[model samples]
Target: MGFDGPTFAFHPDRRAQLRAELDAYYARLYGLIRDELSYILDPADVMGDDYPSETFRVLKNNELREFW
Candidate 1:
């Protein structure tokens, strides 16, 4: 079976828009952590010593899927 509809079309512009929005969201989140939370807790301690991989793991984990 096949489907035909305007919604089925691939939209690069929409994809770019979403990507930009996601980047902005993360930038704001990190900015808040740096400005406000850094005084109370070291970002390294909160994020652990290995931050990039740990952050990726937390984001990709199943438990966060629902929240996302």
Candidate 2:
């Protein structure tokens, strides 16, 4: 739950190597998206795989309620 700048296994009282891998992956992802993502996405309602939609009308008319 913390980002310390060191490449080593963490969590002193733990029982799973998987968590360390996941933590490392998330740290990298967090670093990657720390700035770039905010510019491309709206501050609100950023959900699901709907991308590059020109407008909501197209989304609605296409019957993409499930995706929306």
Candidate 3:
């Protein structure tokens, strides 16, 4: 479902771009802005030490490198 459409193959760069685009789309679909997306990606943006659990850590880091 979340692929490069026609190719439908696994290429690191293409997948990352698609994933980031999907992330942004869903965020907007839910009426969340950039800052809210940031917070959702890494809860630490809103809850620092109080919420030290790593949620979507890898995804967030990858998105930072590829899109954000």
Candidate 4:
């Protein structure tokens, strides 16, 4: 069985909100990663060279498709 009710619809305003939220979420995640890893690695170097794509992959693999 699966969900069978009034499904949520995505609207433009909601899309904008989600985008902002996602940006902030990633920014915070980056900040935390940087702060914790500074002693072992260069945050800017890791983020610039690898983080974006890796983050995208993790999100996709985890099926993080909804934001509220």
**C-alpha lDDT score of every prediction, in listed order:** 0.55, 0.49, 0.79, 0.56
Using all chains and alpha carbons, the TM-scores for the candidates as numbered come to 0.34, 0.24, 0.57, 0.40
Of 1 and 2, the candidate ranking higher by lDDT: 1
Model 4, position 45, has a per-residue lDDT of: 52
lDDT of 4 by residue, 1-68 (tens): 99999989869677778966776677687775545444223344555654443424545444455532
Error of 3 at 42 (Å): 1.5
Clashes (N, CA, C under 3 Å) per candidate = 0, 0, 0, 0
**Selected candidate, larger TM-score, 1 vs 2:** 1
lDDT of 1 by residue, 18-66 (tens): 8667766776877755434432333445666665434345543653465
Q: Worst ten-residue run, lDDT, model 1?
A: 34-43
Which model, 1 or 4, shows the larger TM-score?
4
lDDT at position 26, candidate 4? 73
Off by over 4 Å in 1: 1-7, 32-68
Give the TM-score comparing model 4 with the true structure, all chains together: 0.40
Instruction: Write model 3 residue lDDT over 1-68, tens digit each, in one string.
Output: 66555865568888868878999889989999887787877788777857876679897677678766
Model number with the top lDDT: 3
| Best candidate, TM-score | 3
Candidates 1 and 4 compared: the better one by lDDT is: 4
